[model samples]
Target chain A: MKAAWSAEWLKLRRSRVPWMTVLAISVGAAAGGLFMFISLHPGRAGDLGLLGAKAQLSTLEPSWPSFFGLLAQITAVGGVIIFGITVVWMFGREFADHTAKDLLALPTHRAAIVAAKFAAATVWCLLLAVYLTAAGLGIGLLLGIPGPLTVPVAAAGVGRIFVTAVLTIAITTLFGLAASVGRGYLPGVAVLFAVVFTAQIVAALGYGAWFPFSVPAMHAGLTGADGPSPVGYAAVGAMAFVAVTATIGWWQRADHTG
Target chain B: MAVVQVAGLVKHYGAVKAVDGASLTVAAGEIYALLGLNGAGKTTTIRTLLGMIRPTAGSVRLFGTPVTADARSLWGRVGYLVETPAAYPELTVTENLTLMARLKHLPAAAVGNVVEQLGLRPYAARRARELSLGNQQRLALAKALLGRPELLVLDEPANGLDPAGVTEIRQLLKTLAAQGTTILLSSHILAEVAKLATRIGIIHAGRMVTEIAAADLPHHVARALRVRCHDQDTAARILRQGGYQPLSNLDGMLSMTDERAVWHPDEVATLLVESGCPPVHLAVAEEDLETLFLRLTARGAGA
Candidate 1:
């Protein structure tokens, strides 16, 4: 198991897509910082208040922390998409390049390989999420947020984002596996999109919020003011369960051929 | 003891029998070539042996242990190159082999040595996709040999290769065999198989038609004598009437087989001369693996 994990890690390190995504996230986060600066400028704030002079301009104090939060949210989404794309690429490329035959020929257990890939993707997503969080916080401090940082609140927020990123990564990786081993990308992506969209609609219809697709939104504190539903936790657990089960089924039963 | 044993192995896809009652074995240090055309169940059989697919009906054993369960444990003792070389394209050649080494749990120190031995140092830093098809194959071979597995299963390992590349691979296989690697190579290339295989198993329509050792192959396939002459029809008629079985009439030349008949070059020349058909050439030709393959497959087709 350790060997499989190490092998997967090495492969990920050699790949350029991960680093490229990280770069994109950094750039997007920096741009968000610039946008916040322009929006919070004193001149801009005064001009915006002129049209409706009765509008409360005093409540419009844009703190550096707010900019940090906005950047963090954007970067977080970027990180999720990056991780999702990696999952899809890793799973789909093996079939596309006719390399699955060689992959399955390794002496390691098939289940171990699948688990290792998912673990590697999870670790990558977590690291990216942390980096984005830290970058946001660092930039926030530099731009003159309040002194004496609230480490506990920041840590809690980061932790939730990390969990959300992990759940999303797992779901995407499973979709990749299904796409890779089943047929090709379009079909696999189609199935993934359908499952997620349908789950969202079902949750909206009050069927139940405990679906895998709803976990990330809930974790990000975006689901209505119901305050972090337990459904998100359940969704995480359910996705992890289904991902493992589907991966095992794929490894054991699918024809390991190109 | 046989290094690999498969018995009554069967696998089906929907209604198609991909592998129907296929069974064969490779003994220690022997190179067994599984010969078949496309979709002849060669790949399916290899997959079954590798535990990539569960057999619908049958059993496989490595060494003396049953392989139904705990098949992964058995994989450490075996190496394989299935169809295409499956290394990660994004990884450097060395990285690809190193990853495989890590998977096999080889000692950290030994990984470099194997990579160097496979002559992979030149392309060590080059990503897999950057390497030529031959180098990609070499990387795949390097990975397969990482742990010095006792059994090696190679499926079309020489698919895309120039003559030199083929020779290099052939030498590598020979060296591995010299070190006691029991190899099971599947290919449609008879000449390549003839070069390395100690034993050959011909598969047709998911069934084993013949398992012939290298030494016995010639005897099993009948030898024919070619006689080129003018007035081919007259010579052929005489030969046929004189108890000779004509294999074919090749454009005014005659090819015939007669188990009990001996053709002294001078005697055949005299006979053809007397028959007003002076022979220009007379040569004995032994049947090769290709002919035997055709014959076997044709026989199976008729059945």
Candidate 2:
């Protein structure tokens, strides 16, 4: 298991996919900051160009608490797409690059390989979550927000943002399944887009609490005031369990034709 | 004892039977070559042997131990390169070998040693993405050769290599075999298989048509003596009178498959000369492996 993890880590470090994931999350963070800047002073929005005077910031609040909520929403919405791709690429490239066959029949078991990949994905997603919070806080400070980040307020806001990121990461495990069954990045990416779109529609229909993918964005208040119920968290746990089991089972049992 | 054993290995995908009751055994120190054409089930059989695919009904044992996907202990002594060689495109050659060494649980020194063994030192620091097809193949081979594994399973190990590279690889396999490492390789290139393998198994349409020692391959192929004389009719008559049945093909040359005639062609020449049909051209010819393979497959040996 250790060897497999190290091998997975080495490949992850050397590949451009990790860099791409970082870049995507960084852009999401910067975009979150941009939206906050625009909302704080809507009249000066013209200086920011196209999304300027025409865009409305009616429901948005120009305060630290609201900024953290915006960041959590970004992590929920953008985190799924970015982290989904990261996990998908981790598994999909083995097939795309035709390296999956080499991994089989090694001293290390296939289950260990699957576990190592999941571990790497988890680590990267957590790093992105940390970056999202840091970048959001930095941007809010730069904009000179009026609300004080009291200890209790900061803990509540950051904890909520972290949980949102975790939930988003949990559901993206399905992309790994898509990558394995579909055998490449394109199929997995297609699945990721489909899941994200369906989540939006499902959440809008007020069934977000029942759908795992919809719960993350809803928990982050992407669907307005209502947060996820305990049922939503249970659904997220079930999705994670199913995704990990299915991915590992596929790795062990499926014919690795590649 | 057989280092590798497979019996009645049948793998079916929906309506297509990719491998049907195929079986072979590679004893310790033997180089067994699974010879087949494209889509002839060579890769499928190799995959099953490596536990990449479960056989629909059959068994595979490596080193007298049953092989399963989770069987880790047996793999320590086994190294395999299936189908085309593959590596992490972003990692350098050395890094790739190092990773493989760790996966195989070999000493760290195995990395440099395998790189040197495969003549990959020049490209060690170069990323795999920059490598040519041939170098990528060498890197794959380097990964397989790490730790001087007791058994090597290679599929078209010579693919993408130049003539010199092929010879080098062939010599490397020979050296490994000489050191008592069992090798099971697959290739459609009969010449390479003939030169390297101690035994060859010909598979077609997902079944083993025949398995023969490499040295005995020529003997299994049909051999005959061809006689072209001033009067082909007279030569045929003389050969028939001499109790040897002669046959003619499109070229209108009388040929006899009589083992006696094939062994003692001088007797046939003398008989023809005595019958006043001095041969214009008389030569002993044997069917090549390609012709035998075509004949065997066409005959549906597996059917």
lDDT of each: 0.72, 0.88
Candidate 2 lDDT tens digits, B95-124:
989888988888899998989899998999
Model 1: residues >4 Å from true position, as ranges?
A: A27-80, A105-107, A142-156, A166-173, A180-188, A199-208, B228-241, B245-250, B262-280, B287-289
Per-model TM-score versus the true fold: 0.87, 0.97
Model 1: per-residue Cα lDDT over A1-258, one tens digit each? 888889778777777867887897688667655545444564664566532455433432355434444544463355445766667666666677776665564557767877777788778777777777777767666655543457765666566656656666756765766666665566566666675677568658755346666555544544433433576567567776887778767866776655
lDDT of 1 by residue, B121-239 (tens): 88889988898888888788787777788999998988777788888888889898998889999999777888889998988888887788977776777766788766677877776
TM-score of 2: 0.97
CAPRI accuracy category, model 1 = medium
Overlapping backbone residue pairs in candidate 2 total 0
Best by lDDT: 2
lDDT of 2 by residue, A113-134 (tens): 9989988888888988998788
